[model samples]
Target: MTETKKTTIVLFSGDYDKAMAAYIIANGAAAYDHEVTIFHTFWGLNALRKDEPIAVQKSFLEKLFGKMMPRGANKMGLSRMNFAGMGPQMIKHIMKKHNAMPLPDLIELAKEQGVKLVACQMTVDLLGLKPEEIMDGVDYAGVAAYLGDAAEGNVNLFI
Candidate 1:
């Protein structure tokens, strides 16, 4: 019997392009029949946020953090050449011209392909992100869960 491969990714960057890259890799791995998991931590959790604001109660600091962080994947800025946030807009236009899927669409494709999307529970608590704030169909787990997956992965990546 052929063994199914496993791929684990640690998505640590919140940058739009960076997140897009992570999802693209995950989708590709899934297409190849590998069991894939994306462990979103710290700022990377922003990619899993719903665009609309949810009326969740929070502490003052948490509220401030929410206001400062990008609300969703589309709102995230580029890692470099941001040019005051115009870089992402420019990149989106170029992607459209190239008939490339946007980050949000890529995320949806990942879900359809049965890729495991996980939010770091510890990071969620530190960032004041409630389950209601994150998008649906994501698992919440701590480092141990991710480590278990990574330990058995044929390929492991940190992005």
Candidate 2:
């Protein structure tokens, strides 16, 4: 019997393009019959945020963090040429014109294809993000969990 090949990605960027790249790679790996995991940490957690604020009681700091961060993939900024946040909008327009899948759609597709999506528990705590702040169908785990996946992965990426 042969073991399945595995791919692990540590998505640590908040930029729209970087997040899109990570999801695209993960989807491609899943298409190639690889078990894939995308571990979202730090600013990367922004990609997994919900579009609407959940009605939950939060501490002052948590509320502040929520207000400061982008709500979801659509609200994310680009890593470069942001131009006060116009860069991501321009890129989104180009992507739409090119008929490419948007980041949010790519995320949904990845989920449908059984790619694992994990939010870093430590980062979540550090950011003061509650469970309701993130999208549904995501697992919360610590660095040890990510390390375990990466240890057996044939391809490991830090995006």
Candidate 3:
């Protein structure tokens, strides 16, 4: 019998391009029959956020944070040359012109491909993010869970 392959990625960056890279890799690994897990921590958790605002009550600080951070993948700024938020728009246009998948679409494809998408519970709490503010079909766990997945993965990456 053959052993199954495992791939685990720790997505720690909030940068749009970096998150796209992480999701692309996860999807590729899943296509190759690997057990894939993406651990979204800190700013990375933004990738799982819903594009629309959720009417949830929050502390003052929480509200401030929500206002400062991008609401979803499409709203996230690029790692470099953001140029007052025009960089992402230009990239999206280029991607569409080439028939390339956007970050949000890549994430959806990953979910459809059965790639495990996990949001760091601790990070969520720390960021004052409510479960209602995140998209559906995501698992919540802490560092220990991420470590366990990473331990079993033949390929491990931190984005």
CA-lDDT, candidates in order: 0.96, 0.94, 0.94
TM-score of 3: 0.98
Best by lDDT: 1
**Which window of ten consecutive residues has the lowest lDDT sum in model 3?**
1-10
Tell me which of candidates 1 and 3 scores higher on TM-score. 1
Give all TM-scores, in the order shown: 0.98, 0.96, 0.98
Off by over 4 Å in 3: none
Q: Which stretches of candidate 1 lie over 4 Å from their true place?
A: none
Off by over 4 Å in 2: none
Query: Residue-wise lDDT of candidate 2 within 1-159, one digit each (tens)?
Result: 488999999999999999999999999999999999999999999999999988888889988988999999989999999999999889989999999999999999999999999999999998889898899999999989999999999999999
The candidate 1 region of ten consecutive residues with least summed lDDT is 1-10
Residues 16-115 of candidate 1 have per-residue lDDT tens digits of 9999999999999999999999999999999999999999999999999999999989999999999999999999999999999999999999999999
C-alpha lDDT (0 to 100) for residue 84 of candidate 3: 95
RMSD of 2: 1.1
